[model samples]
Target: MKKIKLSFDKFKDSTIYLNSSKSESNRLLIIKALSEKEITIKNLSKANDSVLLKNLLESENLVVWDAQDAGTSFRFLTSFLAIKKEHVVLSGTERMKQRPVKVLVDALNKIGAEILYLENEGFPPIYVKGKINQVKNKLDIPGDISSQYISSLILIAPLLEKGIEINIEEPFYSRPYVNMTLNLMNSFGIKSAVKGNKISIKNQEFSSGSYIVESDWSAASYWYSILSISDNINNLTLQGLKKKSNQGDSVISELMKSFGVNTQYKEDGIVLTKIKLDTEEIELDFRDCPDLAQTILVVAAYHKIKLKVSGVESLKIKETDRLVAMKNELKKIGCDFYEEGNYWILEKRRREIDDELSIDTYKDHRMAMAFAPLASKKSMIINDPDVVVKSYPTYWEDLKKVGFIIT
Candidate 1:
């Protein structure tokens, strides 16, 4: 669908079955590949990225792998290919080609894998010549780049001759994602440890096991946005979420509390109930859970909450330049968002809501999903609404369960 219009005054408490996490799913898929016959994955994500990775991993006799717009797939596949010693080219969609993969490539080359960029020097569309006769394992890398780069290297460390040790520089945000990777590897019988900024993994074989991916907290953030600003007090049961999750975005449960949404953890999932809000300002750091920046910004703007957030500069290299996209879009709704010093601040305006609000998705799934919740406060049109298929395929339908009107 090119666009969808959303509106709802109120709806009954309902259950929404969240899909499994694409982050965990993609990692487990790599772990499975390493184990070969020793592992099985349950509830793998249906996100386009995970689906493409699954299909490509299962395909045989293929020399060229096209990862499309799936950035995670390309990075993970790059490492996977290097370890398998496969001599082939890994390419992706136009936008994915633009995303930088050189950090991982350089680290891989240092450890004896030959990877060369076929297009731009620091980006994708690369030729992989597999593992070579060289010996190197310790790498010192900057922590500010994508966490996926750190995780990509960690995932392949166990197969190398000397294993690997990574020392991440300070000013590191998004540490939770890297932790999730190590935790997942541990579950598969791999031994790892982190001392200060140094992450060390010893060479070992993956043991036989099964991994169940939890419900995506990133996907659940949209629901948190929905409940936070909806016209009335509505309760939503987010199925499959847990009180304790390794996923960093699970912080949404606590963050939404600032907006007066209480989370009650249940055996089957999480239930969200809204209460009265009296807060005017919130200061947060998105460094660890950058994905929630857009979703939380929407609530802050709607409530006229003064928001001071940091660690979101990384959003520039995401599906789009989210910082610029958000700045441009929030203006339409009368909120002024700009960076002051180290913090990006959102100042709410005292104004009448336009009869209808129109939101552009910028081809970024989070942008579309984050603003759709505004319908609970005002009817809005979401251009490119289907971009949500990147992570949450049933997002609109799930919103419908909570009485959101989409046309």
Candidate 2:
């Protein structure tokens, strides 16, 4: 389908069982791969990213594993393949080939894993010789802030014979992601330490155990966006989301408060109830939660709220150039994200959502779901709606359950 129009209106109440966290699922799968014994992981994400990573890890004969557009899968697999010492090539989609892999590859090589970039010097589609000599235990990488890079290295650290210590240079973004990785590694019985821009994980066997995945809070942000702006909604419940979660994107609960979405945390999930907007302006830093930027930006733009945000510099290298994409797409809705000093401001409240509004997803899943809620304001067409499968595979179905007509 070239485009799908979402015909939506008011709903009093609806419930959706949110998808499992691909973040947690992917990390655990890598841990499982490194484990000496089998471990059971419940509720792995159906997201294309996690599914691809799981399949690639399980395949023994495939010589070239295609990571497609999944950044986590590609970065994590790069490290995992090097550790397995498997002679194979790691590749991805055209855009994936453009995304940087040198940080992880260089770090892996420093620690004695031989990896060569098959194409560009810093990009992916790399050949992994899987010849490990265990040369070094310490690595120094720029902290310009890709949590995936740090997570990839840390996840494989335990498997290193000499263990590993990483010194992250300052100006680090996404600390929460690095912490999530360490926390998961600890849960698997591998102890680690973090001290002021440094991280260390000692060599240890991954303990066998069963772990359940939390519902994707990143996925839940879309519902929050819908409820925040949808006047016809009385109640929207998302199942399987925990008040306390290892996922960094769980911050959506706090950030959505300004948009008048009240979250009542439940034993099994979360309920979103609409409330009166409490403020005219909001300020946020997405360094630790970059994935939520698109959702929040969309919500802010839709309402013509003055939102001053930083930590979004990382968005440039995402699935698409999100900053540019946001600028262009938001332009369609009569909003602007112009720079002001160090922060970008979403001001000049002139929201003019077109009746024939059609949003291009730029091959970015967040772009598709973040802007989906705008349909509540006006029925609109979403291009490349299938992109949501990268994270929230059931996004469209969930929307349909809430009285959204897709045709």
Candidate 3:
């Protein structure tokens, strides 16, 4: 229950180094397990989520995993354990249990994997007993929901005798993540295909091979938010992102364009420079990259820009009830956010800069990190600052590199 107090600080021209990407690390962990050749990954993410996933994969015995607050670990491990034929009780913190797993469980059951919800139906605190002997070669799961479930099944698909045939129920959100899973799997020598919404995999043993994870595009979004809010652009250079990235959040590059941050591709990573602001009201869909919703929402409110957003239904089941968190936290900062059917509206109003803003993170990493950039505009404090450990453990340290004041 640690709290961090942050104050407003102007960005002075400085060189900053950010940690590696957790998104890539988690995706790679599944690939490494499926690889037939011994694989070594470099520049892996140091986030607690990545660390937790690595430890769980290496653990032996009666494992009662405390995944902390990482939803990916929870979802991925559920599928991983089912395939291993091991008896494991997978659970998480109170917030984690509240997140839904029923969508994933039903899919696994259809594939002849035996899984039981220990307590609430469709939520966590799940029990995965020994594996079922049968494997259904072809199955259908909704793709419009969390793609973590799809990745979970894809990771263990190689080990199945019948392999897998996944029919995604809709056009799909987070297609890049599913593709990232397939791309990583191919790197490990197991090829899969997606035609329309139908994805098919052949049961081939994972051949071990080495692969490197790309830095996180999702983490880079915070820097974009900070640059948009700050008048100084000379103080920032984000490293390890690609101009062309498999990460769906790569759309952040184009999204930030509306906020006046121009991204430049370098050999090592991407560099962001602030540009002129657009006076037009902003409208965007978060269906593909729902995680970026909070960061974009905060930036829009700070800039006094009117915003309309959709494709955020998944927010309700994330690390926290993000829609509710945003609604409450934004109220604290003198702005209003409300859902009008499918669209979310942000009404902008200028407030006194001195009105001490204290944000409640609701155990969501994005909630804490997304709001942290607002410190550039005015001094603010975040409750449970440690919540960022779930995704980006070095978030506060990286903020310091950009000249943020933390105490």
Clash count of each predicted structure = 0, 0, 9
Q: Write the residue-wise lDDT of candidate 3 on 41-83 in tens digits.
A: 9988888889989987777674676777888988988887787
Please report, in order, the local distance difference test score of every candidate based on alpha carbons. 0.88, 0.87, 0.81
Q: What's each prediction's TM-score?
A: 0.97, 0.97, 0.95
Model 1, residue 1: distance off in Å is 7.8
Which candidate model has the greater TM-score, 1 or 3? Answer: 1
Better structure of 2 and 3 per TM-score: 2
- Model 1 clashes, total count: 0
Task: Tell me which of candidates 1 and 2 scores higher on lDDT.
Answer: 1
Off by over 4 Å in 2: 10-13
- Cα lDDT tens digits, model 1, 122-202, are 898999876644488899988987889899999988888799999999888799999999999999888998999999998
Who wins the lDDT comparison?
A: 1
Model 1 local distance difference test score: 0.88
Q: For model 3, where is the 10-residue window of minimal lDDT?
A: 8-17
Query: Which pairs clash in model 1?
Result: none
Using lDDT as the measure, name the better of candidate 1 and candidate 3: 1
